[model samples]
Target: MIDQYYNHSTVYQRRTQDFAKSRRISPASTRLYTGASMEPYDEELFREHDVKRGLRNADGSGVVAGLTRISDVHGYRKEDGKFIPDEGKLTICGYDIADLIDNAHAEDRFGYEELAYLLLTGALPRYDELESIGARIGGLRLLEDEYISEFPITTKSKSIMNVLQRAVLLLYAFDETPDDTSAPHEIDVALSLLARLPRIAAIAHITHEAETSGVRVVVPAPNASSSMAEAILEVLRGGPDFTHEEAMLLDVMLMLHAEHGGGNNSTFACRVLSSSATDAYSAYAAAIGSLKGPRHGGANSQVTRMHADIREHVEHWDDDDEVAAYLAKILRREAFDGSGLIYGMGHAIYTLSDPRAQICKRYARSLAQTKGKGEEFALIERIERLAPEVMRDVRGTTKPICANIDLYTGFIYNILGVPETLYTPLFAVARMAGWAAHRMEELYGAHRIIRPAYNSVMDDVTYVPIADRH
Candidate 1:
């Protein structure tokens, strides 16, 4: 077992190194500084242009632009029919928002129905189309035998997400038609990957959990199940002990989160790699790396921790006054910015509420009722009620800064006996479908490489020798 583990580690490391090498870019040869004046400088005209443009809101409120890129397709719009860019140079903050948040953007923050529309439709796939995709993938479960055989299993107690990452890389390696981004095959590959990823994820989860707990290696029962969620639930339950309700909820959650808009970590990974003409596996591996970031796929863990903290101090959280004082103290001590920021609350795109959040919230409430423990539900309600008020008091705005799907999903999964660590992996399982869909779209569209230009504003200076630096 030890030798086998070392071998797996060696292979995994080699593959990782290879992936890094493949994705690397050589530095630009000609280094030109923007600040360097070209020939005759038009300072007077530049000043005049700046004065006319104004310091803020240079483009006026009514000006609108459309984007063909994955980042710009938030499904919701304001009353004026103008879609807000979650993260772009045009937004208040020039930083890119998390892909998950960007994908969930709707006219109303709480537009669950709109989200449902996106999930059913690939790029606004219609209701019937969504049903077809779901039906097609539902019957497809478990990875191909070759995939299962080639999947690298290390003895080290690895992060499940990391294992999934390796699996994604391997998927690229094993892709029979790495260069074929055309019709039927591309669509088929996307559907197959979408169907099997949940099983792969569950295998990773069960394998790692078994290793940690010293349980027997139970090869997941052959995929006799109809739905991908059911197959995974079987693996998790280890026998026929799993409940029907749990299976149904898991199915819905997986289906709902399968895809949103695009430009999320995994989807971005798909887009970036597909742009470069890489295969699906390579694209997916890149995405997994992006998802590893705390701001992206790791939000669920943070949400869980916040809930835990609140629950631990539930006695102290008597009323709005006490909650305000506690929150203020934490903020002051932590030097937190008054952004009304809370884990799993407020979306960059959605202003009303996250539809997924609503679904998960309902499921969580149901689970609480089933278990007859109202504490979690009560805590969620209190936080939901208090969060907006707290934000309003601190930030001078009472906009609907409700909890997103991550928070609700975290709550539901926690109540369902899922370890907090597996939360993101589960997210990955559901999101694999969306990632595959986006990758297929990019590949079919033959989009150009996603290399966005950067505008620098820093002053230029000459490099100095080390000895003469001072």
Candidate 2:
């Protein structure tokens, strides 16, 4: 079946190329096509129409779309039509995220699988239930021999995210009931994906490295580790050389990222697709594509690169004045990608703080010290401290800005020996739980197709025949 699909795709590509060669487009035609594009609308029209651009209210708060029992993200208070920044707090299934992680730490156990179960089921599992879910995930972790060997080798995509998306969409072909929308079946498919995506990402990363270096890469088979964090480290490193502290930190990272409400871009994309009652695979694939955007899941890698540039250009990491000057240059479109924006310095929902960032910083500080990177870590801390002040002086930003989770995620991954290519893919792996939970909610709870209205600004005009045109 895979071979047939590949052959058809090859033929289609050939026909498309042949058709392209048969056409001769003149420069005048190209100019005409470009000129036919729509012009930007006046900003006044948005005020006159009371349009909520980007689904956000005038106060920069997201317009409430729907309700869910999955999780809540709180970062501000509204009183008497005023927005007041507050310390951020995140809860998963009515449990404080800090408490959950702390309890897991006290018990010396990994918590991602437990969090996955809670996100899907909306309740904490018992002792037996936890063990059962872990065993189920372990059982589904290994891909079939053909699936593992054929897809990664044949497909030529260098991006791990693209390969992961392709692998997920293709898994539908192997499902016995790919179109099943039943709750039981959806849960099954979600669990299968949660177990398998890490392995798929690992293989894609290894394959790209091998192709580039011309070194033979030995893909590790799935292991029966006690936790998803351990399994990920083992498979990525091609052996069991990681320590207890590293695995525990990875587990905390996964738990922190597992869910961020249904309103996030990728989860919302999933909900939009699921509202149409599509199959689970299509909804999840769409979510993966959404997450691949730079504004969303790709920000961690950007932050890493931006910091590297800072380390290169800034001579004195300890000198606050020098760091602030470089940051001001970045805001003035003179340095570090010239976008005039810091990558990891702000959050849409959190104003004064992001609880996840706060928690990740604590753990990252310890890891940085252990790995002999305290200087680099302190440099990052200085950037976080100075970026807001620089933004205010240069960009005239009035509202409060805080360091988001991306500020520390890339640093943490580096400490864990993870490649930059896998940063966003690993985000997707943890986010699969959230995506699945929200997809199920949209399918079962919402039950209405999402169709938002768009006000058209173009005036109607009579169509002209080609011969009658100017």
Q: Pick the candidate with the highest lDDT.
A: 2
Candidate 1, after superposition: displacement of residue 320 in Å? 3.4
**For every model shown, what is its TM-score relative to the native structure?**
0.70, 0.93
lDDT scores for all predictions?
A: 0.59, 0.88
lDDT of 1 by residue, 1-470 (tens): 32454445455455445554565623231112211242222334435445422112232222221123332323244566544433211110111223323443332122222232353233544557546665666566656677777664531336777877787666665667766767676667666666666667767777777777998767555454345556667766675557666666665566556565554556666677778987666777777777766677787787787767666654655466665655554434442333224777766555555666766677688788888867667777777777777767655654456667777777777656667767787777777656765676666665567764433345788999989953
Against the true structure, candidate 1 reaches a TM-score of: 0.70
Model 2 agreement with the true structure over 89-194: per-residue lDDT tens digits: 9988899999889998999988898899899999988999999999999889889877866778765596888888889988998899999999999999999999
Clashes of 2: 0
Model 2 residue 386 CA deviation (Å) reads: 0.9
Model 2 superposed RMSD (Cα) = 8.2
